[model samples]
Target chain A: MKKSYITAILLVVFLLTGCWDQRLLKDVRLLLGVGIDYQKGNKVIMSSVVTRNLEKKPPELISTTGSTPRDARINLQRKLIYVPDASKNRIVMLSEALARKGSILEVLDVFYRDPRSALNAKIAIVKGKAKDFLETQSKDNPDLTAFLDRQIVTSEAATIVPDVDLQSIRTGILDPGEDIMMPYMGLNKSNVEILGGALFHGQKLTGTLTPGETTVALLLANQKNKQTTLTLPIEKGVQMTVNILQSKRKLTIQPTGQSLKVSIDLQMNAEAIEMPFGDFSDQKTVAKFNHTLSEEINKEADKVIKKLQAANCDVLGIGRQLIAHHSSYWNQIDWNKEYPKINITSSTTINLTRNGILE
Target chain B: MGTRQADKISRLELFFFILQSVIGIGILSLPYTVFSESKTDAWIAVLLAGIAITINMMINWKLSSHFPSANLFDFLPTLLGKYLSKAVSVGYIVYFLAVAYLVLLLFGDIITRWVLPRTPVLAIYFLLVSTSIYLARESLSVITRFCVIVSIFLPVLLILMLVPLNSSHFIYIFPIGQTGLEAIFKGAKETSFSIIGYELLLVIYPFVKGNHTQIRKVILLSSAFLTLFYTFLVFNCVIFFSSEELEQIPEPILYMLKSFSFRVIERIDLLFLSIWIVTVLTTFVNYLFAASIGIKQLFHQNDHRHFTLAAGFLCLLCAEFTGDRFLVQKISDFLAKASFLFVAGIPLLLLLIIYMKKLRWHGR
Candidate 1:
């Protein structure tokens, strides 16, 4: 009994020692964000944000350019005090020029290969150079990467371009029915401005949506949030901007033989921000305003859908909807071929709850 | 030396043991499996399975409470004849060994896929065996105490799930009840695979204190907690990934976590993976203990120390022989069905036999 107890104690001692791979915070260099740009003749420029002590009076910015992201990252190793691990990287921004060249996948692989890379890190495409967007710093937000991170979460537009992080983008690119979409950003003075959203058909950038179009896309996709602002022409000259307090979208797929009909039902609660026809508190006027607003929102939504259809970018994930709802038909129809020709009907209803502080 | 002298565990320990058992490798893959079947309504399936598991747990607890200080091995022999009971006991031992093997394989696959890609499989297997062997050799009380200590880390692991909330697309979770009942039922079967570990009650039930009422409370609390945890995780994964995207990925929870970015932390999933090691270790320890106890019962050994070492060595050998990931998964699926039989079916049979025997004796 004594020997058995001693043996058990020894076993516990041997197993309990788990300090083999213990890493201290000081020993590891934490990477916050990575920026990729296109250099001359198929080469790439990589800029990364490495977190340093704030007391050190503004940390240095490290930039490296290479033929591939690995090369650029390797080059960056010499310049950076600590080696950047993409596992914890928050954002990866691609230059429009690099995106146009179709090198986003190559750049992303560096992060993907490392087990530590986070799948949820937001991916975006800048209008000009990726460095310009990364370099842009606002007085309000000293950490530019942190500021860009919020744009993906805060945007109310369904078309505000869904935040496509590394994992989702990889999944989207790999999956047949769905495509990837990333936030389109531009440098406005020193601030990083969200220009719109870039749509990817497969791994390549197919087209771009302006902010208004992106908002319309988001609305059609049923991603309209409480903060969604809908602008409507109330009269011949008066325009009213209403804040959507709550919204719900339902898509029903009706399969009749070889063809498929898609119906979209949008329910929204909105409050008027600006009423150009002066103080109109009457039930009749509010009813008329609601009808007009619904029609206008529907029209914008239809236009965005048409543009998306033309671009062959189903960022709305309509293919996924069909698979979930009409599985049999989805299996029968060639999604890539049928998706472009599928007819869509959208019906929207807007309920005016509060008209701001004004009457 | 009689049955009444055996130590009885608290209801809380029983609850934690159940929780630790159920939340094993299955948590990692359930989101993917359920998503493939039910798509958006995967969370619904988890809730339904929770209901089923709760019922099973109640029945098992009732049967167990009938004979205090006696495990499944003790009761089965009295319920069934000696030969049948011995055969069933051997079957259960095999089932327990399979669970240990599956856990090791899962540990190896996860480490290779997420953290240490180049690490040899043998080294990982050895590490798991050594850890589990040490835990299994300890007294039941010590093992339960250690499980409680490790189970405390689960809440912290759950908090890590909140990081992905910022990146979750709520629209993906919309069109609620879209898959309907048929799809939800199919998804429930897939999700139930993860809830199978609760059967450890078969071995530990003898060690539980209190009467039927207390046992019922422990079972209900444990199943309820597991159901909620599974539901929350599946719901989070569904909201985080589109149905189309979810269908393709093998592990949606990890994939979803990959989307988050913090100023101080970049890859929260890596941190999550590290913590999940504890979760896996507890589960492995539970199964190893059960397997050793089952062996000791078969051999009529007063001391379980020798059997524990032998079982650990056998589990390690079986895991090594399982070869690669795909084969291990195939073996695990087959073993899952077997586990359902031992955990649910055998206990049910024992209850029937016990009742029939009691009725006959009363009639006489």
Candidate 2:
């Protein structure tokens, strides 16, 4: 009798577990890209690309405005037939105006607070109207998310821009000694293109570095730059294109009695890929090529440093090193004002290891 | 009692039993909690808590080995008077039930917020308690065997946590002693509440099938293992996030996993959470077992199964009070403070009392 009673209870339990929150695939929309724009009325406009079938149809673009990003999402929820989920959201794009107006941190609160938010979603700043970028329809590309993802990943490998996600953004903003820089994107003739690095002082967008300047910043920051081609003029009109194989950076923060002295040393190994100058006849030419490459890198590095200093953006994490090793020096001054005045120097050395098939 | 005296647990079973009981919902928020006091030195605080709790575990073993084949419920009357012992047993019962309910409440809240939005909170509450009672209703030997089986998830949990280390910033844990020695100790004091499950050693020591020396070795090994386990995870969290970053994330371990997405599995963190439910069930069963034993001794009942059912009902009822996040946090602080008295304070007093009585007997 007890055995029968237990079996019956187990059967009832099996029956009672009918799916309470089963969301069918056809009934839910997968949000791929979200674009948040700050408006002048102390409001925000959120735009998202939602799709029913990923491989079959082009995703639809939708926009709504509210007092906050989450509020805008709620308002957008009203217009959609199916439930919109952001857990699988691939990318988040903010307009230049919105990022400049700041409070991007406040807008990001929804992503951090909601457990369903995709923490690893790639975030980029749109150089123009973010809504326009989100509104760009898929031409040959099946998915805009796929396009943007490829662009960001490709540029990250090529060292055109640094990789930044929502998680890094939150940490960078919260971190006292360091700031963050994200990929700056723009609407091209057909698809999205990575422009450069969008520098941020805390949550606010301070300025931007051009593509050339961004490459130098990345190299000085000890970040990888695969397939990066460096064109150096060994002679007056002779330019050699050297492909960077590996790179290393060493940053030194010297503490004096009055202030902190910061400098960065960079080393790179490269191979001549498209040397338009001439064939490498002897070891002397390779040495000359290496010297020319080093000088060119140093020149660009100095330019990048000057731009960063003028913008007062410490994307190299100079302040982080000071805080970590020399906290007493960090506590003495206001970093925001003193950062622009602090002189940062950079030196680079290049080694042309091989000349590919020519040698 | 004479017939059941043959039931004994092996050393490996005891190891897993202690492990499962100590690591529950506490792991999900422990690093974040410890960081609030120790900052970058949170791992140091975790290490200190391990050392402190091991001493307490040794004391429990000493007290329990004195009365072979007997639990705290049976042997308390010898140390304290009958009335006081009865009162202390009742207090322990309430403490166990309260802790079990808090774990249940936190479990339900995490599931509702992270996994299931539409399922009623009571559904998880009922399912967890029913399964826990099933495990708790068994003999000590069977429960120990179940714990051995449940511990196989530990290696998988470790592998999942290690996956994120490839991308973490090791520099975040730098300036280690910057939070200072005092803050680290304070964090260790705060962390003591999390290591509460070792107190079960006081009750289960006699059931362990070993000599006094073996029991001491087992206790020390489990305590060391738990300390390393917790400190390893805490160290990982410190490296993965800065103090500012950890402050905002309530569950650093889960949040760290959320950042890592495997190609085959989209969210490994959610999978970790699902497997973690089994570990949480082990803790629930441990507390329920402890509480029911207290009830049996207090009421002079031969069948502890009835007491286990009553205890489950009381846990569910109490869990309802901590439904909101604010009250859940409030009662969590209250439980942590109260745990020090029962798990640490009273155990020391009992050991001292037993020592004094032994001294008196020797003098006579």
Candidate 3:
């Protein structure tokens, strides 16, 4: 009697779990890539790459304009046969004009607020309208979603772009003492290429960094990825390619007379991958080579720092350091006002840990 | 007496029981709640709260040791009169029921908001209360066994917390002592609510077989370890989020896990919430068992199965009705205030009364 009663109860439990939240794959369109652009009259134009069928046909590109991103998505949904789902969304693109308006938090409020939305989706700032960027497709890479995703990943690995996602970017956007820089993409002959990084002052895109300057900025900020490769002319006609295996950076904030002086010291462990004429087997030659490489890196670092200061981007988190170490001064002066006027300097030290097999 | 003797648990089981009860939904948003008062020095507040809880646990142990063979309900009538003791026992039962309802409400709220939004909150509440009744109807020994077995998932939760360390900023917790002593103490007071489950020792003391000194050692060691664990969790959340950012996230731990995606699993927060369901079950079962024991003592019954069912139904009905978010918050605040009286206020008063009675007998 007891065993049968237990069996009856188990059967009831197994049979009674109704499918209230079950979502079928056939009933929804997978929105893999999304782009949001700023329009006049406080409107947003949202473009999306949605996959209707997985096997044969390519994904479709649709665009709509509404008061908010969610509103725009709803407007786009009305045109689709099936409901659009963003749970598997891989990338979110924003136009440079939209990012410049400095209401990024408002644009992204839906992603953070919705539990079903993808939080780790890669975010990028396109040089032109995001709607046009999403619509651009090359013959070789027909799927712009996967192509742009892989491009951002590879650029991050090469230390040409900072690794950022919807979730990780929140800290920089929300924190008052820091700023964020995202992968900047541009259209080149109907193909999208990662130009560099779009530097932000708070939520606004104030300036852009070139590819080489981005690497230097990331290295100085101690946010480098897998590898750091640089090709510099050591002499009048001698071009050498160096691969940095390791890097360390230190920033010291000191009060100097009327303003604060911030000094950055960067150390790099480098390997000479391509050198036309160099004998690292000798101690004196290695010392001279290190000196010349260090000098060249220092000059480039100076340019990146100046550009960052001019844009008022504290990606290095100088304001964070001051808030942590010197709160009294942090409370007294406004960081946005003082960031541009502060005296900032950087120096580099390079140690050639390895040379090519021939050397 | 016979069943109580047959249901004796070892020291390790008791330790697991207390540990599982103390760690619950409170840990999910503890860092955010404490930070509201303490700022960057929230971890220090957690440390201070841990010390305070350990001291309170010792006081409870001292009272229980005074009557080693009797539980709280069994000994209360000797201190207070028969009617007053009965009122006190009913009040204790009501408090446990309220806590169990709070647990159910929170569990249902999180499950609906995070994982299964389309599913009804009533379904989640029913599922939790039914399972709680199944184990709570049995003796304390069975509940402790279940707790010890599921303790394996505690380490998994800890390791999942460590994954967010890659993106964390340790400098966010700098200038630690700047929040000052006053704010830190207020933070400690706020923390005391989250770690409120340890007071179950009042009902658990008689069912464990150990001498006073040994039991004291076990209690001290277990409570101290819990304090350290709570401090570690709070410290991790503080370092992971800035003071400004922490304000925006209600459940910082879940939000932190939601941001990270592994190669295999895409949404880690969902996985965390599923495992957290187990801990929530243990916590709810603890309260249900305590309330059932109170009912059995009141009616002079030999079995507690029917009482367990009754209490479970009561909590489920209460949780279903208090669906409004503001009402749930108001209820939890009331429970936190009432917990001080039942967990510490009455026990200390009884101990003082016992001391005074002994002095009067010596004078006679």
List model 3 lDDT by residue over A49-125, tens digit each.
88866556777788999999999999988998789998988889999999999889889998889888998889999
Cα-lDDT of candidate 2: 0.84
Which regions of candidate 3 are displaced past 4 Å? Answer: A1-18, A138-140, A256-258, B1-3
lDDT of 2 at A343: 68
**For residues B1-364, could you state the per-residue lDDT of candidate 2 as single tens digits?**
4425557788888988999899888888899999999999999999999999998888788788888877888888989988999899888988988889888999988888878788888877888888888889988888889989978898889889898887777777766688889999999998888778988887787778879898789889999999999999999998888668899888888888887788999898898998899999999999999889888878888878888988997888777655578888898899999999888889889999998999999999
**What number of backbone clashes does candidate 2 have, counting pairs of residues 3 or more apart or in separate chains?**
0
Poorest 10 consecutive residues by lDDT, candidate 1 chain B? B1-10
Q: What's the C-alpha lDDT at position B336 in model 2?
A: 93
Question: lDDT per model, in order?
Answer: 0.76, 0.84, 0.87
**A1-359: candidate 1 lDDT, tens digit per residue:** 97798578666655544444444556555667778888888788888776664344343356798889889888888876666565556678888877776656677787766656666677888888777666655234555554466776566233355645677687667555566667888877766678887877767787898887887677767655546776778788888888878888887878899998888888888878777565657888888888888898888878877777776787777887766556777779888777779898888888898987778
Please give the ranking of all candidate structures by lDDT, highest first, separated by commas.
Answer: 3, 2, 1
By DockQ, the best candidate is 3
Q: Could you give the interface RMSD of each candidate, to one decimal?
A: 4.8, 1.7, 1.5
Ranking by DockQ: 3, 2, 1
User: Per-candidate DockQ versus the true complex?
Assistant: 0.24, 0.60, 0.64
